[model samples]
Target: MAEKKQWHETLHDQFGQYFAVDNVLYHENTDHQDLIIFENAAFGRVMALDGVVQTTERDEFIYHEMMTHVPLLAHGHAKHVLIIGGGDGAMLREVTRHKNVESITMVEIDAGVVSFCRQYLPNHNAGSYDDPRFKLVIDDGVNFVNQTSQTFDVIISDCTDPIGPGESLFTSAFYEGCKRCLNPGGIFVAQNGVCFLQQEEAIDSHRKLSHYF
Candidate 1:
């Protein structure tokens, strides 16, 4: 019999979790970060980037629904949406559920992340990528926000924790750039890390975002 492989989550220094890899689906070092997808008994298919778990097929709906829907609902009649760094397409899936949303532009830093996730984790995206209103831009989220002339009613930052390629997304300058891309009365929502482990990150983000919003 073969030995089981284990994947350890590297999100926290003091405490962490591990997954039993039932199978290795895909693994690669993309231009931006290290990406890995594997099967687990509990989580179904798991995608991790830079040693941190991004999403799992089992519980993805919980995170994706909250991150994409709450602000869109609050904004009321949001027709255009911008998603930054959701290469997995799970955010895209939830946003597309809104029949009134006429357009969705997802800015992802790594093309490989999107491609691999589409191949290995179809359930996450659920063909939302093929929607006529969906546009996939292969670019850094910060640069996209800064350069785009178009404005959106809701901007969703589905970025990873502030590290590696995602570090710039949490900066004050990036927040300011996103502000520039929002329509008047626009709502911006982001995935800050777990509050218990990343309290300082939440505080810093609040301090920076306060300058713009």
Candidate 2:
């Protein structure tokens, strides 16, 4: 009879040496996409939804930095910020870069994502989860903006791609709500889908945004 393989041996065979470089979470799937969650020494914990790498815990800073800083610097000063759909708190970390920022409201539809990040994605949050300057609301982004009368100096939509649960975020109604939620001089920005693969949608979205703003 063949001897049983050791746990490490089995893992190495399953994921290969590259996959074992640094792992935070790991699970295999026979019916659906193979889920592999790992921490890159530089990028942090990353979730692979369907064998495709999702958000990483570490390098998220690069995206958040570029997304938040360019606008803030161009605007010269920003005191209030609103983030939509950044459940991982990465954007919030970047938005707080301005010391003058008095308040940051984060609207995330799924609190589970946030909770998971708090537990396993420390590199992204950096313990900002409990910061008094930050207010987290687990609610629909559209509804939150619709009900909110307070305006913001900058509104950043850090949502996922326009599929799955984030479809409403890219709708005309959503943009209307965003316009209403922004201060007179407020700037609104969102990370649209890939420019190469989603050119038409991108163009349409820009046209819609132009109409609203």
Best by lDDT: 1
lDDT of 1 by residue, 29-118 (tens): 999889999999998999999999999999989998999889999999999999999988889999999999999999998999999999
**What is the TM-score (0 to 1) of candidate 1?**
0.98
- After superposition, the stretches of candidate 1 with alpha carbons farther than 4 Å from their true spots are none
For each candidate, the alpha-carbon lDDT, in order, equals 0.94, 0.73
Cα misplacement distance, residue 7 of candidate 2 (Å): 20
lDDT of 2: 0.73
TM-score of each: 0.98, 0.80
lDDT per residue, candidate 2, 1-213, as tens digits?
554321121222235223334545655552322445565565556755434344675566678888889877777778888999876677887877688888999998876667666666677777776778899988888998999977898999987666655778998888999999898788898988677667877998898888898
Worst 10 residues of 2 by lDDT: 4-13
Worst 10 residues of 1 by lDDT: 188-197
Per-candidate Cα RMSD to the true structure, in Å, reads 0.9, 6.6
Candidate 2 similarity to native, TM-score: 0.80
